[model samples]
Target: MSESRSGYILLGLSALLAFSYLMAGWGLPVEYPGTVALKASGILLLAVYAARRNAYLLAMALALSAIGDAMLALGPSRMTLGIASFGLAHILYAWIFLRVLRLRGMRGGMGYAMAGLLAVFGVAILIWLQPGMGELRVPATIYNGIIMVMAIIACLSKARWLAVIGALLFVASDSLIALDLFKDYDPAWRGPAVWISYVAAQFCLTLGLIRERP
Candidate 1:
């Protein structure tokens, strides 16, 4: 096989490891060390792919996400740290997406449309989870706003389809976690739901960014 194909194979393996370990936590009851290691592996591999392409911002975002994954998997005590890490990652992603938009120059109407959608989407989420977000209301709202802006930027940029999908999936992943944290959900659904969306989100963004110019 060609080198590119082999590299993809390696990245796929890391993502698979992450998924497997996350599942093990839900089913196999894996220990923290093993789970966190595997969880971070997938994102770290994506960072490597970004590095290979010299996509510096994308690499930094992925690397920060990997750190968040590790922090989160370590357990409840470290949740705040994990959130902070992922928050930074989202900011970096927003930077990358906005830069892409500036360079590509979206059509006039499209920018307004994206902004409206971002506002509507972010407000709707805050409304839906408002009661549950009590103490977390402010931070959650801010983070939601950030990611929504990232999604909006992606929607208006050249890589609209891929970036949009990836951004939304990332939102879904975090939303599930938020649900589990503040509201009631089927206990069994928690782990699978979070990891599935999270992993897929990273995969989409990483692959999409790799395919496009830096």
Candidate 2:
């Protein structure tokens, strides 16, 4: 089969796994050993696709995301490691958006305003979660700030709507996780919501960056 055909197949398989995982719940208690692989499989598939397409940076980021998923699924003890993996992934994503993909000319005042708004949003979120962060406060703050910077860079990419949307979805997904983890707002829908948004975000970011002029 051609790369296109294979890519689609991988994506289909990923969607299937994501759907199955959702149906089975997040498998929070490690129902089985396969649970970790099942949780990570979707993004791992995407990482494979990215690697095949020669998007090494994107592949690395996706691979890290898969690892993060697996680590988080293992238990609460691995949460810090999971967050660190994701933080590094976001840093890679920001680099890709700012350097690799050329979207549009950055506007002067508008650019500064947009970045300022994102910074404010990140700080606000950090403040809200500060009370509950306790020992994780500094890590959470750094992660939050990095993700927001990633989103800001994506937005300033101007015409690259795919990257912008992906970054925002990623931010939204992380925000839900923060609420579920740090705040007193752990809704039943939070798990599925985070996974769905995160999957879509990664898909968009990968596809967008891969399509950019190399």
Best candidate according to lDDT: 2
lDDT of 2 by residue, 1-214 (tens): 9989998998899888877777667444446667788889998998998898888998999999999999999998998899999999999999888874354566457667877887888888888889999888888888898899898887776636677789889999999999978886877788889889988898888778876545
lDDT of each: 0.80, 0.84
Which portions of model 1 show Cα errors greater than 4 Å? Answer: 107-115
**Best-fitting candidate, scored by TM-score:** 2
Alpha-carbon RMSD of each model: 2.4, 2.5
Model 2 scores worst on lDDT over the 10 consecutive residues at 100-109
Give the distance in Å from residue 119's predicted Cα in candidate 2 to where it truly belongs.
2.0
Structural similarity to truth (TM-score) of each candidate: 0.87, 0.91
Tens-digit lDDT track for model 1 on 146-204?
78878777777766566668887998888788877767664877778788888889878
Clashing pairs in 2: none
RMSD to the native, candidate 2?
Answer: 2.5
Candidate 1, residue 134: how far the Cα is off, in Å: 3.9
User: For residue 114, what is the lDDT in candidate 1?
Assistant: 68
